[model samples]
Target: MSRTHATPVNAVDARLPASGRLADRAAFEAFRAAATRRWDDLWSVERMVVSVGVDSSSLAKGAVEVLAACRRELTGSDAVVREVSGNGALWMEPWVEIKRPGQPPIVYANIDPSEVPALLTGSLEERALGVRDGDAFGGIPALDDHPFFRHQERIVLRNVGVIEPESIEDAIARGAYSAYFQVLFEMSAEEAIAEVTASGLRGRGGAGFPAGIKWESGRKAKARPKFVICNSHEGEPNVYKDRRIHEGDPHRILEGILIACVVCGAERGYNYIGGEYPLAIQRFRKAVADAERLGLIGQDVLGSGKSVAFRVRTGGGAYICGEGSALMFSIMGVRGQPRTKPPRSVEEGIWKRPTIANNTETLANIPDIITRGGAWFAGIGTEGSKGTKLMTVQGPVKTMGLVEVPMGISLRTLVEDVWGGMRDGSTFKGIQTGGISAGPLRDDHLDIPVDFDSMTELGGMLGSGGFVVFDQTVCVVDFARYMTAFNRYESCSKCVPCRLGNPALVEVIDRIRLGRGSLADLALLERTSKHIIELSLCGLGQVAPMPLLGMMKMYAEEFRAHIEEGVCPTGTCPISVAPSALVAAD
Candidate 1:
């Protein structure tokens, strides 16, 4: 563990103030008491800390070459390297951790960069993977008893992977704008909308709805120029937990969208996001320009004359701009689709006036329901679904990453006891918790209960969570013709049953997976999936035929074995197709 060189100014970001602006709430509680004394002197105990995670799936599995091999091997040693945030243990990509000085934090996994000098000489205790608060070091086990983070449950990923996200003073030294400094000095906006309607909060971007009745109807929509966007436009398809909570805690959803722009008086706000999330739009535009150069959000903010203002628009690659009046008409640049609701973006939005979107995990659970209230965040989950959700699992789960739990946890305990099942001898065959209009549970609907009215009572939903998984090597009629060619190429076809019933349910699930024939083309793929779910306009042509009509009503014998005994039962579809070297080159 060679590191005797003590001098690397602002080691990796946390010096904090470059300009000015925290002129109120007693100068932001004396700048969060000097950013909690340099975040407890960067984790004291004679210093050694380190961390190194850097997300986006650990920067495609290397974490920037383990943060340039921990600054080229703990540059001068007393070690306190930085760049944190990927604690979802993404199947252990790069990762790291350390702690030392008297030991405690440990971690290590999938290392490399020539194994960081044999992981600083402890010679990589078999790539650790444990040891957070104390004990179980080399024998590796405690990271809350591992098993991919034993039943997750973190509140908005509590300072996601432990702070340093482009440091807004390490997120106000880990307390980040104390609930926007008690709603900018001792509450009101109707007690933060009655503590987020006593915290039974919803709309985790899958339409659970009730976020304090959509901010008290955008604070009684009398409208003096209200707005609050943030629907991040995350073009779904196995979503990435709102791109890892916008690269692990973008100022906790920008202090829950600046407490929903002070309970909806909303001077302004926006964060449309998706341009395929280039690192959550380059780490939320350096956290809204270091929270607007410390005023803690533009003008009179912290000094509390009460203004508001936020920016970071980005998105243009539309997935119907992740809906919500097409993400407030793609932040007003327009043509992002979804409209006709008489007057609903909290009473006419964007250029018409009042609005309030809130998605990235529902404004990341509104800064802990305004710093620990609302019955302590509605005493955690279940009961019309409160608190945590995040989810994102992905395929053959033996820890595919991201999870937060607590909302009537079941899906057989988030895939067999918190992500530790289905990767051995793989053959479970079902799950798709939500995304691509979900609904495909199997294995007796894996014990149900994942909230949002028990996944909308099994017609299936709980969407934005995006679990996925599947097996027996997949082929439910070519997975309903690749989810109807991805909802007919992201249908913003304005309307007309998704502009012609999702290309006629992808040409009747591609002539019933190829072997042609048909009971009237399976009754015209069930009445063109009930006329595109009864005349679709929005909600993507009404759940784009709920995953090809829930895989023909639960794999109707794998769509009558490729249209009446032609054969393809999990042989991954083939039936009467050309291939003996393409029929001897035809």
Candidate 2:
């Protein structure tokens, strides 16, 4: 945003650092002090801030009109109706939060224009979700105690509902660049990488590789102009965590990027977001520009003499582009297809230089790791998988929303407790972890701790942390066929296994779904799925058949019902025993 459009609420005042480059901690402290005062003023009885959740999810549910309604209603009042980002409450959107002078901020959900009056007048009791700090608005529970949000750790989403997504001041007031500032003045690159490594943050983008190990490789390489890329172009079905972070907590992601740049000595950084996320892209673009103005990201960042240039590259919404090498391919202006890696991305990535690619959620953890020492983060979660994970629990879950919980929590806890179980009295069937290409975990597997090794031990990749919960209304065979079809449609066509094997698998499942399948076809599916996993060139192909295998292995009775009885056990698939032509040919 330009100076003309800047207001006292969003703009930086003269109390900040005199130069774009900060010389010492004292300068930053001055800025923080001013920001704190301004921030506190917004919540005071004198001013009374009415922050509206104006994120992408809320906007879809008519949040703009709600915001407009708040502005119209509080036109002459001392209350300030400001726009804040979403807290990932998808089912409870159009949130209206009012911070009364003596009381804590009360959050009311499903707030429409019609409820804006009741909200300001404190008559909106039924729409109340909870309170951020509980003064009891009609006895709604505290968010810290809410069933859906109680277990969430909230490191990545710390500023989500607290700050304006577009306001750098709001971001700063809530401790955005403090970690980066600390890193610039307090720690060496080696020490920085050690902090992350000690924190045990694995890559949140599919392969759960240790992030510190990748940074070490990137730093040790005898290469010039190292690069850091944030893969926000998540194309997995029913996964919206990346877009949610990008749109709601963009500065957090950017701060993580800057920290990575400092550690890896990268001169350039790229946030490869998908084009489908227009709001995220727009907000991120503004974030980059604003940071450059504030000297947060430039040749000499905050006078630390460390230079970093960051840019945003939007993809054309290809699922394959979510893969690391395929993302590198897209960024290079080439066909977004995966290539075999010997010289991994850390050794040779975009433009064939040493690069470190971390996904949106992975990088978002960096700033926090730096702020509160590495050991602090390592203390959370299970022994192997440390720290928290930002997860999107979708499908028919009762309280479907984005949650940040420590790793090693069972899917049973996530599905039953955090997300409030199945919606509409639906019986639990299974779950699809990661993308459509991941696990369709059964009821037995619900007790499995949701860590990388545990999920992988069950033959599923915990990629992207997007869990698609299903109920008894879904047929395992039908779900496998649909997921296989998705893989078929999204195959990059570079390799035969993904391109050809997906269609072949789709045909077999289709036949079974339509009641034309023989018992022999199940064996054929098992063989082909294994074949795809073994000979596939990339992660997409490698995991494409997981759904088929998961259903076949875990829910064999369902497949048996489809083939042997010529019927769907759940009565979800449309069975037609008509003779069909072979889909064996190209």
Candidate 3:
């Protein structure tokens, strides 16, 4: 779309000190006191409350206006109305929770403004409290008990949808910065890095590089004024994990950044978010301001004598800006393009200084690793890939939204059990993982574990954890052409292979689809694809041929049918036909 950069506002003007709101320790004490009180006292008029967390507020059409209408209509009512952040369950929003002290929360999904009046008046019969048959328990099923939620291990998404995005108090109440505090006061920088290395935490962006090794590079580098950049430019199509995390749990990200800064000896930090994500930009900026005001990010942070300056910079909506070197260049007000490595971003980056650049989800895992210790975190997921992964499931699935599952879960379980199988009675054909860069896998590969090494072994990379399902009706050849077109558009023109090769691939696929291809064209396509893969400069160019390569290998019969038979096996492509007059003459 467009590119814009913003400097963070000074901490003083951001907001009032967080002391005015409830701290985590104080919140726990208050909860304890409220628990022992009588039911009548607990459910008093002052305690009646309702909260809404409209997921995908910005992208979900009319959701923001609907939320505003709900708030306005609830004005002057005995119940307290509060707006919260969504829990990554975009399909079930606008998710609402109505609670009275000592009673279970009454949850509702996909609520419209027209239903608010009746809901506030206690006309419960007119509204469905849950999305599915077993979703309602007593009033509404506990959020954790839902099948979609029960299978997840929410670390980065811990406070999401449960707390207000802009409220530091609400965040702390849910243990937002507890890990940061423990890391700051109890653990040494070396100790923190050791813990992370032991946890086997890898970068969640795409490349599964170890987080500890990256931090250690910055630590050992002989440089001053080291920097850490939070790579929040989530530009991948059909992936919304980073945006949802920033919108729902901004504080957790901030806390993670602070922890990274401390461990890596970074005196300055920048959260580089994409310009397309206005809501994410706004929320993260506000969160940085709030943290600064509370001494969580500025000089003399939390009275620990540690100092760091934090800022938020927006990036142009280029796909390449997601790369570390390209992102650093964007921050420096240059063209957002990738640079050759040897002196990587960790060694000499951001004005030729040592920098620890990490993705949003990677940094979000830091606080938990610090507090729980490395071995505890390592206990989850596969031996090579530890911790949970946040994935976006779309396409033909019955349920489509953001989901977090521990690493090593089979794709079959995720598609069938988590997503509830395909929609419209469709049969599964294949799945595309790691966004557009990775290859596709057929139904037989569904049983494979979704870890970094395992996915690599299956000729795919879990690049950013985007799982899109395809049904029996999909033509693999057409899908490859579409993906190649996308790669052509986003190639950055940095190298000849991606810039020139992708367009060439698209043309060949189109020729084959339109009944103009020969046996020679198939050989040419394969040769050209291999050359592009071998000669590309960046990951974008390197992975450009994956979709086409994958399709040719997995569905060679489909390609042969199009070339030899001149008909689309899946009936998705149209064939040339004789004119009506010509048919009559015949």
Candidate 4:
């Protein structure tokens, strides 16, 4: 796909004067009023609007061309064409919306530039376009009314597709920094921590650690030059929730960071994002600069007598860097490897001082937690896992995209209701939750709640809310081999068990796949898996063997058939005829 130079329509121009930047309360309100008045005008209404987000920009460049073409053709029609954040449904990219003054917005997905002229003139056939829906407000079947969105309880993703990502005015109008201001002026640092603790908010970064406890430790730790880190290095395959937030709602994240800094009494902050997410990095950089210009993140923030410095650091894209200690090491200008936990990051972190590290989603939830109060936030999800979770569903599902569902939601409901079941009427087999690190769960396990404890009880962990579905055509053995190989390759080689055992595990799985395995090989595989799990230093080494072990336990009959019959039951693996012929000859 071709890259387009699409800037946010609400982005503050660099050439503008200081007063025009709208840094203060009066200036921001003035800007909001003017923007709203312009939109509310009836005589000169902007007839058509085309908004493209990171997902669409990555998936369909043709939509950008379509937007440009529409702008040129409708120059006389007073139409507006601009880039906006995606609605989290990545499958419907290059999503276009047409709005008249009084009529509901006309939504079209996967739009191409070639269809621009016809669409503007109302001459295009709706069936030919990709996922068309109209009359959003008048009850004419809008995108939000769809099951994929209707069932979701959006908290972090509330402002994603609704506002321009770079528009601070729009974000503030929608209550972005209100929480930070509340925390700064109304509540004391201890009060803030107590509120979060009372709300039962836990970290969304797979560990399920309580956020309040971490903050309290940072606040009380006897260290100077404290720091806060936002972990956006989402290296898991097919997981893009953090990237989406960074791209679509950069200000929300910044606000959350500011709140954390205030509550933890930290003056320095770092946003450690993955190097692969160029767009997210760009947006985040702009958001920080914009916030600084507005006196929200620098010296004497909002005139509240507090100062904080923030920087953005790009990781080397190692999966292990997602670990807290490993992320800190990368920021300290060293190799991205996990460190042993004793002092922990809260007590001793970057520069041997107190630090608080949180994932992008975890930090993003802070603003809401402060604004709504901890108890209000806690009342939403299950008894243990409070609040909502942003999940990325891929693989054989009919509708593969990002979804924000409440905690304790069953996997069966998510797959059948939200995703509309598997594609091509395929039978459901299993799903790999929490990315490749977590083990796969069979169809029978679908009814189990997807909270942290429930998933852990079933030998799976919600390792950042990645749910990849598989169909009947998928072979569990082959899938296990693929996941194991990924972990082996991405291992940081910091520990002996992971560095050596991962490749050995891959070799054993390959031997079984080739119909050359025995019961003795299975015993060796189990022993090696246990050794890797117990002896490894960090999470990467410890959880590396989960997929392999899960498949061995869940699909024992399939493995037995591959060994005794020398054939793959699902026909996904190629079997050698020589093994069977040799056995017959014997």
Which one is best on TM-score? 2
State each model's CA lDDT, in order. Answer: 0.78, 0.82, 0.77, 0.78
The TM-score measured for candidate 1 stands at 0.41
lDDT of candidate 4 over 464-520, digit per residue (tens):
899888888878878888888888888899899998998898888777878888878
Q: For model 1, how does the per-residue alpha-carbon lDDT over 336-420 read when each residue is reduced to its tens digit?
A: 8888887887788888888888887888778878888888888888888887787877788787778787887787887877787
| Model 2 regions lying over 4 Å from their true place | 1-27, 134-138, 576-586
Write the number of the candidate with greater TM-score, choosing between 3 and 4. Answer: 4
Structure candidate 2, residue pairs in collision: none
The lDDT ranking, best first, is: 2, 1, 4, 3
Off by over 4 Å in 4: 1-48, 54-61, 125-139, 574-586
Q: Which residue pairs show collisions in model 3? A: 3-316
**TM-scores of the models, in the order given:** 0.41, 0.94, 0.89, 0.90
> Candidate 4 at residue 452, lDDT?
78
Q: lDDT tens digits, residues 1-586, model 2?
A: 1323224333323333343544446666777677777666566534456888877788889999999998888765546678887888887788888777767788888887887888888777677677895545547678788878878888998888788888777788888888888778789999999999999989888788899998898878778889999999988877888888877778999999988988888889999999888999999998888788777888767667888898899999788998999999999999999999787888889998988999899999999899897899999988888889888877788888888989988888999999998778788888887677666787878888887778877766577788888888888887887788889988999998878998999888888888888999989998998889999999888988987788787788889888888888777676732345323221
Prediction-by-prediction clash tally: 2, 0, 1, 2
Measured by TM-score, how close is model 2 to the native structure?
Answer: 0.94
* Off by more than 4 A, model 3: 1-46, 57-61, 125-136, 574-586
Candidate 2, poorest ten consecutive residues by summed lDDT? 1-10
Local lDDT at 187 for model 3? 79
